[model samples]
Target: MTTQEFWNKVKSPEYKVTQPRLAFADVLVQNQDVMLSAESLYEKTKTIFPKTNLSTIYRNLESLERLNMIYKVTTDDGLNLYKLKCASNEHHHHIICTKCGKVLDIHFCPFDTFSELAGKAGFTITEHRLELYGLCEDCRK
Candidate 1:
């Protein structure tokens, strides 16, 4: 998302814009292609606003996630990584490069098929997340 678009979302009455928050969002926007952990993001944000604290980064991340402005994924090793949500904002999945931390949107949704199977078991689905992790072409090479 562009800086303007990011600001537009952040303009909600509930959220107050601040320099630390802006720097945090800017870092995510500047590195949209790769998912980053809070620590990694904190390091980058500190470069822009040296006085920023780790707690601030965590708070910003949690707030943005609640606003649905960012995407979060847990790595195989259990590290939580985040990135700015794509422009579509539609229900979707991701195919990520485990080695390089690159993410690509997957437009397909398997919920329909799963729902059918789930119905046989007398269960209903509420929500789901599907992320496929592997080496991207560049990493494979």
Candidate 2:
């Protein structure tokens, strides 16, 4: 999403987008890959807005997360990584490399067909998160 749209959504009564919120949204928009921890984001922000602190990043990250502008994933090593979300992007799941700790975005939603079958079988599926972990190509090399 564009910065203007993001800011507007945050400006809504329910969101109240502030300076920190704009900073967080701007960073997320730039971070296309490398899902980041709060600390990582703080490090990046320091270069642009040196006055920003880790606490500020942490607060904004959590607040934006609550607003569903981003989502989180806990890596196998127990670190929380975040990524931005948008209307056109589905971001179905990820394929994680256990060896080198890399994450690849997998846009295919395996449940779509299953959900159709489930509907025929009189079942309603609400949601799911499926992650497949293994050695990626570089890791295998």
Could you say which candidate leads in lDDT? 1
lDDT of 1 by residue, 35-132 (tens): 88899999999999999999989988888888888888987689999899888869988898888789988899978999999989999988888999
**What is each predicted model's overall lDDT from 0 to 1?**
0.87, 0.72
Q: For candidate 2, lDDT tens digit of each residue in 9-85?
A: 66656567666556666777677344677887888777777678888888777777777777677876799877765
- By TM-score, how accurate is candidate 2? 0.70
Best by TM-score: 1
Question: Once superposed on the true structure, which residue ranges of model 2 sit more than 4 Å away at CA?
Answer: 14-19, 89-91, 96-104, 112-124, 133-141
RMSD of each: 1.6, 3.6
What are the clash counts of all predictions, listed in order? 0, 0
